[model samples]
Target chain A: MSSLAAPLPATATTAASPASHEDRSSFAFLAIASLFFVISGIVALLVAGKLQMPTLLGNIAWLTYGRMRPLHVNGMLFGWLLAADMGLAFYLVPRLCGVKLWSEKLGMATMYLWVVIILGAVVEIPLGHNQGLEYAELPTWLDVLVVVAWLMFAANIFMTVANRKYEQMYVSLWYIMGAIIWTAFVYLVGNFATLFTTGVNQANLNWFYVHNAVGLIFTPLGLALGYYFIPKAAEAPLYSHRLSMIGFWSLAFVYVWTGAHHMLHGPISQWLQTVSILFSVMLMIPVWTLVYNFFATMKGQWHQLKDNVPIKFMMTGTIFYLLTCFQGPMHSLRSVNAIVSKTDWIVGHAHMAVLGAFSFFAVGGAYYAIPRMLKTRLHSQALANASFWLWLVGGLSFFVSLWIGGFLQGLQWNDPSIPFIDTVKFMKPFWSVRLIGGTFMFGGILLFFWNLLATWLHRSERPAETV
Target chain B: MIKKIDKNNILFVAAATGFFAIGGILTTFAPPLLDASWAKPAPGLQNYPELAKGGDAHADLVMKGRAIYVRDGCWYCHTQQTRTIEADTVRSGWRDVRSPVSTPDEFVFDKPHLFGTRRVGPDLSRAGGKYDKQWHATHFKDPRSLVPGSAMPPFPWIANNPAELDAMVAYIQSLGRAKDWRPTHDYEE
Candidate 1:
């Protein structure tokens, strides 16, 4: 069964292979980041479990719901998603271009800076040094770390692309390059614009920061990983290169304007809201285009998923991506927004995308990179399989429960006859389900980490024992 | 056709960033200039100017309480914006009459804007006068103490500090109150 170590892509056009010392160093970073992901995932789920029970630390300052909420979110966004994406890029970019990483030392530096900033946020946000923006909560002082880390990431990768031994850029290259540039712009502008603006003007900036963080940062990078992993795992050509281009450019054009939809029916102008809603609706085309393109590429290879762990993760990610995009545009409609805004409905949608869709991409992509970097098959196929099922079942449970709870909450909120606390009371049962689902999800993350550790240990070289 | 641009990633980066920049101007930069309502402040003097015309600004104690609210991250759970919708307006008359829909100007003085993203709890736009200091203190110390079904974490440890408790209640009391607020049209909680 362990003949599962797939051969390197036959299309090696690179002079410096992915297994070079430079790219291989990313195994350390990826391993560390995944460890952080599972750890923080457990903390986040623990907070969810305690929602109905007595507080975990009884409000010892940072353990309260307020502090834990941001810690959970930032932990997921930065510690898990962004950090892992960067790690994959470390392996993917070097291999795709057939060039040695521009600088492994610099990559390592970026990882450290990245972790420190996230750690600082994990501490600072809960301690009340927050910027008060959703998803962009790091105080400006801590935010500077992201800017520095991005520049380091950019300089290294842009230089690698420059020195590429290959002439043609693969699809992953375009996505990785674009994701890096756009995220820097979005994070910098989104975090800092509030300094110059006031009132809803600042709100315009805040929501822009919040939405684009997911759309620009997570979405493009996620697609990058999916593009690389799917063809490599399935041993098939992408359905249509032209279609991929269409999806890429259209996504770039459409995603930026969709942020203000979050501010709808609030104080934002009707025109702004209209533009957000319309652009969001327009997003459906590109959304379908990508989904169709991905599933088409999997034609005749669907059976590989049973034996291929990475493919399983990627396929699951794509399905959730489809669901997220569908729900996103539909909910942006004004009628839906009326009932859904400020309700648990938004939280449910967030889980569908953040935890369900894009995060699935990170998992699949990380698994793909780990074996390649370590020069071994995943240490335990059974553990990987277990992680997959647990994640799938837990994720689905989390989504269904929250969605029902949120929808009901919205209806009750809309109906003035039902007292508000009654709605809260009714949601308790659903919250209990969410807690159980969260536990399984957290358990799956732990199993994934354990598998990575086993893979690292399987390496005959004692990199672990020495260090 | 795609291969040419792939060779030169610099151009692709520029193109992508250019699109975002254009979007920024259209969506973020230009909208407020087009709509002046974003920063429009409420009418002068805080003691219900519509009724008597010489209301004072919100109390200093309330300002201190607002700081505590920010510190505790109450905005994470409780939203402050009540939309111009029928359900929100009617549900609020916590004290005497139906509450008024929230206005843009009610938030003009806010620096970071406390229009929260979620409502794990009820909207706090008109949380003032609905309960007194004792209620707020008790509620903060242990939310489930008041409502057994609350998702709120008990903060008795944090609330034990008198300054924290005092400031928090004061800030909550300041919600929905403005100098020129009309009793019938504005929040009276």
Candidate 2:
């Protein structure tokens, strides 16, 4: 444990490196977003518990399972993960472009506006001001605010890149730029366009929004960070620029067609489902190419996993991304979709992508950037390592438990002889395991947030020699 | 052209957007607006008869009930779409009778469609008339009383507000019944 927690001497060189005075907004965004990360965990814990014992907060209309579920989903996806991604974007775009941000003031304004959007979600979603769409639950007005905030963010990123000193862009820039464009289109279609339509067509549109919200928005942001930080952590250049290009273009093409896979075996057209299945399988091409590129970059740097905390988080994220991508395409198969589409298995699979894969990348970004931004050593490396392990173990246990529980539940649902109540009863032990796993994961995130906050506050006893 | 895209930010953004729009337009944007079959309502949903049932006052209650259902996040747990699978047919059927597969017309009245992805409970697409309004009321008050070990949260607040409960029950009954396809008596176990 002592060796694992040993102080990183590399921080000294980075601390001596030139500080980007323009990164103030990045620092503020990362810190505030980390706060949401902690709060979202608390909401998730309560929601997980309520699933096992429905009456835990049964009487409270606001905390009921229905309202709480969306609150938890939106809070984590939008509030924590997305906000952190934006912060990473603010940090990466400028450095990669070799320029200060176009306007730090606008960046700060975007951060505050984002906080307001999340706070509005926290207040209004509980009051039943929901849109009733799974991921698009925020009311129409808040949706408008989100679009406005994103516009401000995109303006900053695009303007910064436009003024870049370097003519040739890195892979990270392409991903970030692609994400911004795709997000605007996907979000508007999901939140606004669906308003005019109802019934089956609306359901078709809803899933298009749901799947792309993850694929177009979070996936690109996560990859942008991973592309930047993975090589940085491994101390190597990307293995193949051509491979990265292939991965990007292919993903952009294949991902949008696969959203209908969510509706397989349902009432939507069979041709549409078939198209989705084909694209879903094709998704493996980009995922594997990216995996191969990352692993190849880290070819001889494998031993760094023992000592470098950020690389550990990132490499593990890469592996989770692989597993999640593999599982996702398989789930889209008609036979598999029949059993698991609505079961707890889908829930577990979702967490594997968001919590296990992308969350790790975002956390690694913080671990890599925060100290550099602050010009200080981390408050405690040991605590950071401990948080990583706890998070890994907790996330895996939570996923595996549900995978087993939901599979059996899906099998039982298919069997007419087994009563529905018995299937619900069978989930008890698995839910309990999930709750326990959630607790550890929550504890780890709390430590992570505290470490970063403590570093920002200069709370560490170590000398602040740089200042 | 590739070199120009690599060096020019605006050109690169244009290329990225172009690639994405192809798939987006093909899959999501085009289908509902242009497709012929998707616009056809099922015979039951051909008219908003369910909404017009019992004159304006009853229609108001049903609308209010739908609001409560959405507000309480009921759709998170219970899906409104019944797939064309044996499991759904077996599970949503009345006793041993197979309920009709959910057609597009069945959901014509559902604005912002409630075809939820997961079924934490059961698919409620054909849930209309499966049980009596009284049974739903009792279940809302205390789900465990009727179905022990049920994970459904008790909506005791709705019970306290009798009007709201009635509206919710009405809305629940209207789920698949907009077509009046099933006999109410056939649903009992």
Candidate 3:
């Protein structure tokens, strides 16, 4: 076990290496993010139970469905997934650039600030101090702080890229840069511009932020991590540079137009809805191109999935990513949107991407990066494998039940014969199933946290105390 | 071409920005500014600021109710927009009659519009005059009592505060009440 203390041979392709604190920074971000993941998992379970029986929490204002729903959604998106993605970004950028992170002090500062912003959300959102926008629900002051935190992050990443020892960039680097730029632009427009606007325009702008927050930020960031880890874990080079180009460019162009699809059959303009659907279907091009690139890269590495846990996670995520993308485009069609627009089916589809796909990628990235960052192997690979099964089975059950339930609910809704309350009653059984699945997912996150903590505190190796 | 752009930082960033702007401008930025519906007031909103009685006080109650609605995250469950679909028209009727499909003009006064994403309860678009104030008060206190199997979280706190309760009921009753439409339903307490 003492052998773990021996320094990891520098993995950078060039002579430049990461600063010592970079390791600490990445580990801190992931650890805090994982804590939020666990917390949000508990919140999700409670929220799911409340959906089956609304009186579960006994009329507490703070624990009501409305308050807790945003907490669960934002907690998972910003508190868990985005935080984990940032940690992974910190891990990947320096290594890819063949240089130290631009500023270790700034990186640490940004991590702490990110934690503060998330904490503010946890406190304020449940207290009913939100912007009322779907994804941009944080209070105004907290939203301002978020912009500042993100800017600090973006500056560090860009400066690192600028100071790279390697002149030629990897595909992962492109995605990272794109994620930074796109997030800054969209976050500003969503949070700030919406403040100035009102009525239908506000709704339009709000959807733009909601969709892009996932598409431009998390999607690109998750893909960057996936691109790096899949190739590395499979011990194979990326399959097609052409596919990479086609995927990256097409996604960048197409994703922005599709936010309006969320408002389809509602009050948005006909032409806007038409353009959104057109672009949404065009989204298939990027998704397939990327999926093919990933699968092709895994050629002859199929056996790695049996032993390499990171590869297993990345592959599952890639497959789920394919499904999520397809479902999203299909749901945008007028006929399909009419059935599933506001149902639990949208909820199911949402979880497929954030949890089944991107969360999987982040977990895989953490599995790969955390061990390397700490200079030790995971404390319990068995526990890691157990958690994976829990996530997969639990996630599938949650998604499938909701999809079925939401479809039934939608059908019942369209039939004038059935009363609204009956539709709500019809969903009770599915919500119960969802709650059960959520419990398993919550258990999975606990194990995930336990495994990471054990790996971090494992007696064999600890990071040096004095820098 | 890929290699050249990938190697040059400025060009790569420029290309990314340009592609993002092309779709972003067309979908989100351009449409609202260009559309006439965004600025025009709907017929339903014509008398919203002036009720039949207690004009300023009634308007104040509606605004206060709007704030309460936003604060409680009511919009998360009860969507304001009535889609131009059969399900919406049939389910969320106005005083037992189907209201017209929602228009952009109807939302002119709503800052940070509450066109919510989900229907965890029911569409509140045509909620006005569908139930009496007493029904709303009872519903808020315990949703399942009136409509069994409702998953809506009870706002029992509102029952203790008459002012807030009245405001909430007023705001709900203000929905979908065009110049021609009038409050008709009167439920027994």
Error of 3 at A112 (Å): 0.7
Q: Flag clash pairs in model 1.
A: A14-A98, B46-B55, B46-B179, B47-B55, B65-B167
lDDT of 1 by residue, A166-237 (tens): 987887888888888888878877788777765677777888988989998999888988888888888998
1 against 2, candidate with superior DockQ: 2
What candidate 2 gets wrong by more than 4 Å, as runs, is A1-19, A459-467, B46-55, B178-189
> lDDT of candidate 3 vs native?
0.85
Candidate 3 residue A236 Cα shift, in angstroms, is 1.0
On the 0 to 100 scale, the lDDT of residue A256 in model 2 is 89
| DockQ pick, better of 2 and 3 | 2
Proportion of true contacts reproduced by candidate 3: 0.81
**Cα deviation of A405, candidate 3, in Å:** 0.8
| Per-residue alpha-carbon lDDT of candidate 2 for residues A1-467, written as tens digits (9 for 90 to 100) | 12211233334444566644457678777777788889889989999998888899779988888888888899899989999999999889998999999998898888888888999999998888888887999999999999999999999999999999999889999999999999999999899988987776888878889999999999999999999999987889999988999999999888988888988887788888898999999999999999999999999899999979999999999999999999999999988988888999998999999999999999999998888766677888898999999999999999999999999999898887898889999998999999999999999999999898777666345545664
What TM-score would each prediction reach against the true structure?
A: 0.92, 0.95, 0.94
True-contact fraction per candidate equals 0.60, 0.87, 0.81
Which lDDT tens digits does candidate 2 get at residues B1-189?
987888988788888888988888889767766556677776655334354564677677778888888888888888877688887877777767777777766666677677888777878887766777778879999999999999899998897788998888777776776455455463432
Residue A162 C-alpha lDDT in model 2 = 92
In terms of docking quality, model 3 is: medium
Where is the poorest 10-residue window by lDDT in model 3 chain A? Answer: A1-10
